[model samples]
Target: MDQKMFCYQCEQTAGCAGCTGNAGVCGKKADTAHLQDELTGALIGLARAADGNHPTGTTHRAMIEGLFTTVTNVSFDNEALQRQIRIVHQEKEALIPRCGSCESRCGRNEDYDMRMLWTDQEDVRSLKSLILFGLRGMAAYAYHALVLGYMDEEVNQFFYQGLFAVGEDWSMEELLPVVLKTGEINLKCMALLDEANTKTYGVPKPTVVPLTVEKGPFIVISGHDLKDLKLLLEQTKDKGINIYTHGEMLPAHAYPELKAYPHLKGNFGTAWQNQQKEFADLPAPVLFTTNCLMPPKESYADRVFTTEVVAYPGILHIGEDKDFTPVIKKALALGGFREDTVFRGINGGTQVTTGFGHGTILSVADQVVEAVKSGAIRHFFLVAGCDGARPGRNYYTEFVKQAPPDTVILTLACGKYRFHDLDLGCIKGLPRLMDMGQCNDAYSAIRVAAALSEAFGCEVNDLPLSMVLSWYEQKAVCILLTLLHLGIKNIRLGPTLPAFISENVLNYLVENYGIAPITTPEADLKQLLGEA
Candidate 1:
């Protein structure tokens, strides 16, 4: 029998149209998506089984690994998905044994159908969606930190709480707070990751990165980890190979320790979604350290290598020792373009600045606070996140363009490309728009917020700041959850709410934290500025 594929796993599915015929918008075959769902179902069962028994270290790691595998654009192998499902099932069966010496057996230990959560009321669905997606996002960061041997106790406990809520039958009243808590817990997770990263690579400092690619062999490294890039730079030093930044990894240039390297050339391409076209026929090899790995096209597939948690079939994997020899060899064999090649971002700018981590932001805190007090900085708009190819995502450009002149925009992730190159003028010797690094660097935003709150002797929400966010993947989900956890209110999120959130869950958000979907920029800006 012929079957059709139907999936709505990402923000930019066809027609905002969930894939429903034979493959996902992401090219996930129907069979693969089904296996993913099965994996998810088994995870819920494992979570339920662990409800009273308490998840051990092994179970916690398994839980995180299982959920992370199903995030959109992460895995496509049916065999891998099935193996994960089997793992979850095994874990569940081990955690909760069958009814012993019972006359009649019941389905109490059975795996739950994920569709039940999907088909629930919108608000209920939305809140649970927040918990699930937020955890999926958190799992990525936790996994990254885990690889580095840094783990937070509070962060790990919340993972269990968030997953347990997903399998719950609670109403909006019950799940909505949990939804917001997802954000809260993610804050700790991001903090843990930030600690893991900065301690491993030193705190990031501001530095300018060129867009000019030097002649001869070079490697391009992308994704959100500075430690991996630092290791690659160390390994590739004096090896006749240069390293460039791609996507979120561009911020590596701003960190003093990383910038101190002579061979760390320049940036190669733009955001994650553009990889298929950007890396096509490129003369140098590229390495992905984390998420947003699209199935590599044959033209550039061989040139791509993955390290840490990221993996692609037939692509080279750099393991625990973090050795990057294979990627360097590939770069040498490619020999790069004969002359210096200049590439511009979408805005045609030749360069970008990054490394504005919490250290840099807090260092300028007095200036920022005085500016706010003196009315020099009237508003702060955080315009940042992963950028996607969706048509309406242009809302970010228009939103940033229309932001009032008195506002200071602090951005992160690949989404800043929408307008990062635009010269918005400066506020008190600081650029009007400052990039705080990649998605994981949202921790910087949190630190800045907390410091501002301390300086003003008030809560972060009472300050004249508003979060205008755009999300494209699991990392964004965790960041959003972190925001909610902080009790900050009135966040404007768009281009569209996740398809995973149900209406009742959406209502819970609206009623409790005033979280609302993004409308037109004019409307959102007016509402944020109190004109609404």
Candidate 2:
């Protein structure tokens, strides 16, 4: 009720219920949080205005950008958020000019107050949260696809539909199916992004990248934008500087088009959660192309630069020019490591491999099938999601370590940083541990699972696979909904269930989908292996 604010969208919220005070657990100031809420409300108004009217490309783009900007750790700059809110408002006015004098104009000032959903009945709030958060996550994927000049009308239209439902007074029964549809639509969105990425960048192949930053002037590119990376690689091509991928950008080394750049060197650090310490006293500028950007620490604050949707106050941001002049100059001025510096993953391994996308994996479908039939591989554990700084996240590391030698571990997103470096070795010819690229690359995992299911003549859930995922934010929300929509059962989620989910909704998932919070690694592995 106070102006302080309330948010519980991420896994590590205050008290695991909500963050209600001066700031959120992600270091979002109260003012910034309010601005995000305002932006969301404005988006809802824009969705309402466009529901029955013709909307332009600009309308759709604003909706996508507005939703993505609200993602946790994506944008912490109130000024940027205000600018987006104004854009949404303008789009709404364009859709229905002089709607202010219309008889059906929205109350509660103008836009739908987000507080209504936050304070609604627990069941309604839970269902709406599922839809809203899932929309936010799906928007990230849609935005990526749009960046590559790829657009799906079905995907874009769903944004308007979902946002409209959020503002409506729909019942639990009415909202339940929409929640699942969010997953269904996100599948299409992810696929659109997959096509865009592969067609534009070429299919990814297995490439082992060192955890070493090469000597000389270099730049650290973080977040999940391949287009930005390609541009940086092109601009810095003949320059004396080197570029290293960090966080989710680590997968860029696997794309054929991106890998062709000689200066697009190795990955620099581990997950986003450790960026503060990993980048402390760094010698080069770090360009953030998307989310998982924490409030920069003053120690390395000067080196932090933002582009696209990721922004923080006092951070120098690269604008629409898509120019890397500032980033390049900073990298040159800083003069990277005087000598080659090798950094090890959390497990102390010096190298990691990625780019095992659907195309690459399915290319060896026969090999994978033969390996499975020959009893060389047992259960597959998909330990993937966003990496966070919360305690108990070590569960992923232990789960991978405790997985039997006969089993295979399929990892993606920044969460793979936990155990990716561990030498799980190979079962047959396939590596026991395979990095499936970034979060949206979950599409690759889905593709591989569907193919394996087809080969085995059974449903995906009936295969020798178990998804033990670690979630931190909204992207995880949409992916979970997608799995649920696929009717995949027995998903193990952790380190903590989403705070936005009420007890009733949690029970519904547990009853219908066999969803459960993850326990100890040994116990979970035993149960998943049918040996409990």
Candidate 3:
């Protein structure tokens, strides 16, 4: 409470303790952080109000909306946070109509003071943070599925249950199960999303996306919403505006529904962290559909448009109508690169491949199994998670590079941008480095791991696969929890351990699950391969 604000939910938090100064490393200000906490507190109250009542669809959506807004880099507008807070309070009031007029009132349903959680006993805070952050991440996937008209009663209900638990005066024992259940429930959530996406857009197929900005106006879309991209693609079809995926949207190029748009030319830049430099003086408008949006610099500020839960103070926002006219006009006026301009990924390659989803991978299960049996494939590495601007992220690049040729690297999310362009060649005709769609497609990895386990007659952990993950924000938290819930151990996480994990809680992970912070790539690779 004494500091300007408190935020340590991200990997890049100040000093690996907390970000309590004027701004977080993500470029979010103290005031915005404070507003986000207030919004979270209001959501806790909403969940508390729904404790004994059957929450309506409206209530379910409000819970998802409010939680996703607080995700690390999602919403930076104080007014937007205030607006979401008002909606949360209204939903809570609807859930308990006369709670406001209680004559002898108890404060059971009042908005929580987030400072309590931030200032709680360390271990208790750690457990609650896991549940809360995990819920926040799961909410994002839920929101995406919701837009595509997919709903799971269990997933919707867990959001309320998770929020209520966060507000309770409970011991660590009471909260720990909820922490892992957050993972259990998220598996369902991720599956629901995978179903929604694959059903709406036919299962993704392997495709190569170029990094060139063709000579014409183009709009760059960042973040994780495929619905938004589909709508934008439909709107811009044959309009002379080329659509380019950026950041997490890079995986969009692999989906049949999205890739069918010829104007959906290719990917534009690298991960979200590089946007400030990538978008500066750009000749096209950039649209952000979800998180990982940094504060825009003055140079590119006018061209940044946001939609859904993503909002910046002054950026033009495309609302529910999904109209992309402003974006189209801006692109035309700028008249993108007068000539076809070539761009390269971080590794200097002009193109990258994606869409090796569970469907595709499982289709060739026989071949993969044969490869492993014949010693053509030696190991499997799932190098996936959100990418950030941290210097230590170079570990992922090096990890992928040093992976033995006989091993297959399965990656998803923006982390692939680090070495996405690298040609790791193939093992027994299966690309050694396979991209299994977006971070949401972690389900693909889970499915493949399960299928492999079945084929090999062993536990997934007993398989040759090792998870080397890097995280930046909330979605990563939920996915990691899902991994733990599945009892899959020996995950190597970096660039740093989460700041909210108390020493005791961290030890619990290490002691029981073998969760370890990443060390040097040489050391980790050797140890994972039994060469150490």
Candidate 4:
């Protein structure tokens, strides 16, 4: 059996290229990587079976969950991955039970070996990589929405089309449209998720959260699943356990339903990449509800709990029942900090603010337009995305810090942690820096930009808005695709582009969309603000 693995579906791949060694950079073992490949292949087979047949809700969910399972840092447990693979197979068999017993065999319903895609021509491989990775990211959003009892049929069907396309032998011309279409569909997916969240939790509003941890038992909830966090909040209510948001969950502070809980405390840590160090000897048990789960350290591994498709082999996983009893017990045993401890963000500020969803921002659309029209606000910069261990990520912090007083910075996702604590002051009554929910809240940013464009009678690009984005994983890939799909050009993406994008495809994007890698903060800021 081959013991090596090949994967480059993320920003931290080896040598800025594919990971083709015994283990992936994310600490996925060779065996686990192989299982993920098998799971992906099985998903392709399920998608192939649904190509002609009308897929049911069960089939759509299986496809979404399967694709999301293979995302970087999502699933490392071989057993759990195998279970998902079996579920895919069962769905395929239910779709076409007679395929295996036919007198004459046709390979149309066979499972795809992912190695075929991995070893294809460079350009085709790059295009398919974009589609597949973008689909994976979109699936995460779809899963979040599904759990909230909201699912878009178009978004669900595209999962099958995307998976089947991954297995097809197609030209760059044929595949490029699918690549962009992944983004197009993901835009709808984000919209669906936005609707699911707003309808379920009420529109988010501007809310300020402190960084202090009161002396009591607390559970730190990470990842991007609001439903899971809500369930935990309900269960831990009046049980003497405080809930603190971490990573992408920091945006929970903005939602009215989530923030109403008095015990739902402030954020605890910075970005996902800092978990290993941040969780070291912590007093509370951290529950991960979605992606960005780094392999836990031995010191705090016992206190880390995972749920909702996030699984690490040795970590305690809270199953579908969403029972957080184990986590509560662990937190109570630890008893939190003996004294009130104030935890500042990376910027040394003791508190940060969030909420500024599309509803909140658009409610003040007239004010924003008046400010921009009067030249009181020169530019609007959407500096957002995930945060990683790369030292270059500090660019976001500096970029926001150096923005002119007349400019407004709209940020989302964990990347906001870089400067969310800094008091950037306000323009009129609005803060110079506004926190716009989580990574998925890129939809909010889009809505706000579209409203601004409509008010000014210009395209989104023509508005005084520049998108300087920093991506660290697959979610960023899909959001980037969504931006390109909307025909919003001149996007500046960095801490280096994805290693999976081949030279030709990179050139194509550069020629058509004017997407460029970010340079120094000073030069980029000057260029963005038109001062260079």
Candidate 5:
């Protein structure tokens, strides 16, 4: 079939092959998709140029920004994408200013067209897609850390290596290792971001956030950037406006310095997918700090503000200055609800608890070990990742709701919104359901799992821990790769496998890692419990 565009970088691709229609499933137009491909090709060229030179901080930042611009739902404006392409080209020129005018032009430094990778054999395409998409996700995490004054040489260099590999004429034998290496490096990237966050903001603690919106003007801050949320909170302080967290930003309520702001109220909406409906005719403005931004509806489009790397065609973006005055004005102008408006989570509960990062959990590690030994905690289920708009996503809610009384639920990202408010009673002295911060905080889960394995004198997979994950975007891609890279096995991934994974690649994963797409929660629960 002839198509204007080809994209399978997201979970919502068409027909589980690629988005080859006039518009992608995520509302990306053909022109925008083509521009994104161009932008990616330009980034590969930049990586190619950086091969022999020592890339400066500016080079690394540009590469990260360019990769992140191509992530799904991050940038929809063709003009913005074209601008990114120009920036990449400028970086490449700065790295090798004489390459363009060389007498004997060697094609080694030329930009690689993405169509070549897209049209390769299925397995090759799948492996390259894994590397490309994983790099995109890791770039976002690295960008966050860079903003907070943290940068890792290894993590920064991997961007160039991975991107260069994507453009290489390498077979599966060569590319496969690089694909796995993407996961290996992403682990470092996530850890860097974790260090930046916990150091910038204090270590997170168990904090209960309300779903109720008190009467007053309020701005709902969404996405996963704590730095952005903190700046907004500071700017809006004592301005007679309340700040509410949304989507992945819900965990922001647990940060000590952020929670200190009295006007920083509770969570507002659910996950990112629910924004269109939830933000419709809302009295206050909504500010997006990162990805999972759906196209704003006309109803509330005027009140939507984007900051940092997130951009839409007409949305007002708060620049690097971190000034949030426009968002505040919009919030004050809307003049929120006449009285207090109470909102409940999907499970019909009024409050959800967050924090519970590695620091908090490890602080009580002895108690957790004792509870397990005493049989009060039978198992640990990490039901985490981004929340999607698919029909079966409620499987997470059901899985958490039906977990055995003796088991504990550790969750992260917006997926926890499915059951975050459920009043699952405690085991020993800890709440059965623990929110482990945002998707980036998957590092915390890894740390805790490693510590638990050391405490039990067994491999991580040998422990009574299960990973039941739901992925919606590229961030989830990098996190899943990190899990695979660590040799963690028996992972259950769903509500649907990525369309980009060819059947052969899926088989390789299944046969080697025992990764299975989730079925019914009851059946999977039985299998995970060794009863199937």
Candidate 6:
């Protein structure tokens, strides 16, 4: 049989060889995936062209848009993908004009083949994969920040450097450091976003968000953005429509300004992967503010809405006005589930607790320090990342399940969905699973780590914290890079390392940082706890 279009970039890709055949597990057709790859290749070429020159605002925006478009489940239309490819080409051609129209053509102006990077030595490939995936995830964050009038110069420049390196010939010794550099730079990028978000929407505080949906009209907001959710909350305020957050949006409850909106109700569903079924025939319209949007099912497609970096054909898109009138109208039309709808999480808990952001964690810094000093808290596990459908991923579930009662699990991103519903009770009133918000809220994890280190007068790694991460996409990649950038050690990553990382690159990560693929929850737990 002819080889299918291989794209195992996501955890749920078909047969672990990518979604070859006709359509992706995400319902993306093969052609759309191919076009996305083309867009990526063109982005590499654009970066190569700008390697020696200044990348203009237009080029930067195009680069961010191109990468954001390729994020899993973000786009499914081939036409949209082609338009993005054209935009990448236009940005590149605009940056570097063919001087004198000479017959001496420069290969530098041509699209950089992704295969060239993919087929290289394992180390080089792995390092490049880190840069590519890291930048892709960073672009998503950057795009969100940019929309909110926040942009960082260093972050934009690294986008070029990271992409340019992907097409370069380099060894493990040469490329390994860039892998970590990607992380280092992403820290700055994420910090910029943190400043942007908190500055734009007040620092998040502890707030009780109910998961129960009140009877009457309501809208479900998902993805990782507070500003968009806030704007939606503002527009819909007093419209008689209640707003429930879903996925990363759950953390919005912690923000003072957002939580103040009485209409902003509790959380709705779990992570993005479960959206199709979760939203099926839902009475209320769902608005996507960012990534992790799976392809729409016919069941509730009409009620789906997109805004800012999120787009779906025929779905009502609330534009810059953030008016949200259309979404509000849709919710009233659907009328939500009959009577009052009470939804429980995957772990069978009717209510899940969040809002334990950096602010809340640091406010009780003295107590946490006391707890640690007294041996009440043995270790801290940052068990977070994008949740997916892999079997072994149950490792995160079991890992959190098996965490010693005294240990604290600081989780962010959708991976928490695996166990967010589980009420592991609390350690001194702090819920066992403290959600620090979306993946971008990894900033909160870093903040808690840094604060704990300060309290102990030691480096972050010296604290009893192990990053047991589950990555399914580029955002996770960038966050992992950020962790490594901080010189964090002994991270346990699963369900499997990215296929893009070559053996050499894996070895470099293992040798330098002691990062390892996850084993059984029992085995990994023992090793993490130092009992193995």
Descending-lDDT candidate ranking: 3, 2, 4, 5, 6, 1
TM-score of each: 0.91, 0.98, 0.98, 0.98, 0.98, 0.93
lDDT of 6 by residue, 81-153 (tens): 7888998988877777775322212346567766676456656666777788788888988887887788889
Candidate 2 or 6, higher TM-score? 2
Q: Which ranges of candidate 3 are over 4 A from the true structure?
A: 1-3, 100-107
* Steric clash pairs (candidate 3): none
Tens-digit lDDT track for model 5 on 336-400? 99899999998899989999999999999999999999999999999998787777889999999
How far is 522's C-alpha from truth in model 4 (Å)? 1.2
Model 2: lDDT to the true structure: 0.91
Please provide, for model 4 over 319-356, each residue's C-alpha lDDT reduced to its tens digit, 9 standing for 90 to 100: 97888899999999999998899988998999999998
lDDT of each: 0.79, 0.91, 0.91, 0.90, 0.89, 0.81
Worst 10 residues of 1 by lDDT: 99-108
lDDT of 5: 0.89
Error of 1 at 55 (Å): 3.9
Give one digit per residue, the lDDT tens place, for model 3 in 370-478.
Answer: 9999999999999999898778999999999998889999999988989989999988789988999788889999999999999999999899999999999999999
CA RMSD for every model?
A: 3.1, 1.6, 1.7, 1.6, 1.8, 2.7
TM-score of 1: 0.91
Candidate 3's C-alpha lDDT? 0.91
Better of 2 and 4 by lDDT: 2
